[model samples]
Target chain A: MRLTSWGNLSLDDYQTFFYDFNPNLLAKIPKPVIAVGASRSYGDVGLNHLGSNLLTTNLNRFINLDGNLVTAQAGINFAELEKVLNLHKLSLPVRPGTSYLTLGGAVANDIHGKNHHLQGSFGCHIKSMRIWRSDSGVIEISTQREPDLFFATIGGIGLTGLIIDVTFEATEFLGNQIKVENLVFSNLSEFNQINQSSQNYETSVSWVNISGKKNGNGIYSRGNTVPEFAKKITKAPISYPKNLKLNFINSTSIKIFNNLYQNLQKSIKISLVPAGKYYFPLDGVNNWNQVYGAKGFYQYQSVVPEKNAYEVTEEMLNLMKEEKTYSFLTVLKSFGDKSSGGLLSFPMAGLTFAIDLQNQGEATLKLMNQFDQIIQRAGGRVYLAKDARMSREFFESSYPNYEKFNSLRDPYFSSDLSRRLLGF
Target chain B: MSKILVIGSTSGIANEAIKIWLEQGNHIHLYARNHDKLKMQVADLEIRFPGHKIDAFTFEANNLSKTLDQISLDNFDIALITVGELKYSDELVGQIQVSEKLINSNIQIPLAFAQTILEKYKTQGYGKLGIIGSVAGDRGRGKNYLYGASKAFWETYLEGARQEIWKNKNISLSLIKPGPTNTAMVQGRELGNLRLAKPEAVAKVIVNGMERGKSVIYAPKIFQLIMFIFKIMPIKIFNRLSF
Candidate 1:
């Protein structure tokens, strides 16, 4: 069977297996497998190109929920978890840009969102997890118990083992309402300053325009949860029309969209919005990625240190302008000093930016390679979860601890990313 | 808050009705043949609606009499019967054993369970009973005569029961005849020409009919007109028709 992740950049044939509710049925699948959860990763991180992918989407179930903790099967995604948690006035501490990612996928990717400046990545909030190892039997690991395996598995990209269930701590919220403030920014420096001044808010992000006309103009937004007593408690159905898929995101269309988006947000000051609208705006239109035409698109995300943040981002934006490249969405977020225990966790005390560009064959690949060089010069690293093509040497140089992680990886478990980087 | 019992709870129709009742802060007991799926579904329901009480049991609906005896029902206010089986293969038309099993699953089992529940509710003098019937039962078609025959039997049975039970103002029985609905039972069948009703929409009709003390309901509303036309059609014309 052929499968493509969220990026839709590449589709490769894979051997997929489903493990139902029966526990004994899991042991029947062949070894050398990569456990896939929702297959939300942009690249081949969730796909085992050489072997089979043991799909865990069907194993979704709520195990338990205590005072401030939630235990759910790994197959459960944030979309399902958020619905259940909202009923109890609780919310996830660190949610990614998209809520469709599975719990296991979040752990494997160690995803971070606009709130990363405070709560760190998703792995930082996990209390404990259970995994079915190929070398060993079923095992429960945590930061205190099996620290080595736990840390390795936390952004291990499913190379460690098959994660069965996860127990994580969640935050109690007033309601699903959020007070948002959007401010127009002039350049990269202004965006950084705005992000720094908005430390009091729960979430902060910047939307940039990278086309030729208004290249550096953007809007910086900050949001905080509405107070319990003041919240309106408006519940709207999260339905996306199936007919909204439009393959109109070519060079011409994106340029028009970029201008319109910048103009729309240039005047907005403050408003109250739903948590879903504030956190996952792309979710408003289902399969929003299909707008990038039949060939799909690629996301290039890189994080540079505080000192090189302004210069590195400016250079990359200038390069895109010089190349006459077009990207529909260019998002920027700042990371906090609080690091995750995951051995290969992506976030650091730096500035991260993600740009979505349509895949135009060799031209797209060449442009990405150039961006990689610029990022490497600024001592920045690419996020593996969002990467479709990054050199193996660059990956090794960026993550110096890869050797230790490789040694702990399950002998029978492998993925396309691991095969590309570690020559497995 | 009413306590409800849902039979064949794993079916799409039963699940949608369960969600509506749970959202209203009602307690529900789910019964299905697959224990593992039932447990997972029950846990999911509990998580989705924390304040409501939810429980699950594993037993075949074909033997509902033996199954119901094992479950407790002290203060149950409503019962929903959504158990059914569909056989569409042309190969099974002349097979006597297969047809008999289909009759048992679609007619005998549900009828027996409905009769037992109606008797118990008749004594209680204040309860709601909901049974699912298909619009295909309106007129026998050559394509799916076995399924049509079973549901046609249920319509007659329900009509007679409604006459006997409707004298009591407190007791209500709903006969829901849903049109072509999107479900696993009709997976491979073409539905381009027929208006496909969502299971959620059909489930709502069933629940609403029971709430309004309605004895008969044709889901999607248009099915009522379609069925009326079928009922009035001449025997000569109906016999010659394929559908």
Candidate 2:
């Protein structure tokens, strides 16, 4: 079977096995396998390329929910979990950008969202998790018991073992409404100023118009869950046409889109929107990546230290313009001083910039390699969940805990990213 | 608030339908083969739909009769039988144990449960019964004749049962034939451009059809036309083609 991650970058054939929520079935899967849930990671982190890829979507079963804590299988995505939690007037402590992410995926990636400045990454909220390791069989790990392996497994990129289930704490659910305020920032420094002043907001992120002359000029939005309940609105996601042969996103179209988007937010706009609309706008369109065409697209997300953030991001944006690689979607956010617990977690106290570039084959790869050099120099690291082409040297240098995580990785578990970087 | 009985409740489509029914405030009694899995599912549902009445029982094919005797079926407003299995073999003579298991699981167990429930429905004077048949039952191909034969039996049984219960006026029986769906039963198979329907989508159609008192339903509705073409194909041409 052919398998790929959300980025649609590397569609390679794999020996796919579906998890049936049976422990015995795990023993039968061939060695060097990785358990993938939702395949929401926008890179080869979930792909094994000709090796075994254990599809864990079928393991999606909620085990229990007591008080403010909920336990569920690894394959239960946030969308399903949120529905159940909403019924109980509860919500997840850290809500990622998209609700389609499975609990295991969120932990493996240690994903951060608009609220990272306050709640930290997803791993911070995990109480405990059970993993099935080929070397030692199934075992439970938590902060107290096997603390090293527990942190290793979080943001461990599914290389530690196949996560079986996780118990996580839920946050208070005020309502489904979000009071969103959108402000315009003219430059990276201005964006940083606004981001610093908006610390009171629970969630803050910026959509940067990288194609424009003023680098990082775009709308900066801040949101907080409101007490007022919003009327439930269910919109069916529109899927991108599979047969479309050409990529419609180019320099000209991107400019038009940026202009149109800018026009919509020319004035400071304040509106009450649904939490889903505010948090997961991209999820409204299924397979939106297909619009990049058969060649797919690459997402380059990097977090730079706060001191070097402005200068480094300016240089990176200038480099993208120099290379004539106009990113269709560019996002910027700030992280607080909070550890993600996971050794390999991406977030740190810094400013993070993410952009999507069409897979221009060698050109995109070369440009990303250059971006890595600047990020590495600024003591920044590319997000593994969204990286498909980071160098082994860069990975080893960027993540100080790489060796520690490598020591704890399950010998029988491997992924395209691990095999490429760790040389397993 | 309706009392719904779902046999083989852990199956993908059945489980999804159970969720929908639970959301609609229906009290569900679930029965499955694996005790642990059944218990886990029931627990999951109990937490998801707090305050909803949910009861579960586990029984193997050989012990279904004994299990059925222990439980009462007098109050169920709806009963859905979603018990079936698919096993493929290339050999001319498949293993006897496999054949026996298929027959017992797909035919005997479901038939026994249906008969018991139908009797209770008849005595109680009103009920809706739904059995998940398959489009394969319309016309068996060389690929899945064993499974097809079992569902074909259901098509015949339900047709007769619908006529037999026609005078009851309040009683209804529906045979649901769903096309290839994205269930565990057909998850990893290579279908060559064939689109498998989502279990949730199929469940919605099944529950709607059962509520509307449809005697026969082809979920996705497209399956009705496809099955019609297969059901009337010339024998020679059909034999010459392979699916």
The DockQ-based CAPRI class assigned to model 1 is incorrect
Q: Give per-residue CA lDDT, model 1, range B36-78, as digits (tens).
A: 7687688777887876788788877546667766443465789
lDDT of 1 by residue, A355-391 (tens): 9888888998999999889888888899999887899
Relative to the true structure, how large is the alpha-carbon lDDT of every model? 0.80, 0.86
Model 2 chain B: weakest 10-residue lDDT segment is: B186-195
Worst 10 residues of 1 chain B by lDDT: B186-195
Model 1 / residue B124 / CA error / Å: 5.3
Clashing pairs in 1: none
Tell me the lDDT of candidate 2: 0.86
Q: Write the per-residue lDDT of candidate 2 for residues A1-424, one digit (tens) a residue.
A: 6677888878766777666566666566667788888888899999886457887877788898888889999988898888889889898788777889898898999988899999899898899999988777889999998999999999999999889999999998889989999999898888888988999899998998877777769999998888988778887878888668678988999988888888787664999988887888779888888899888889999999899789999998889878877876889999998886789999999999999989888888998999999999999999999988898999999998999899999888899899998888
Residue A49 in model 2: shift from native, Å? 2.0
- lDDT for A415 (candidate 1): 83
DockQ per model, Cα: 0.17, 0.39
lDDT score, candidate 1, position A383: 95
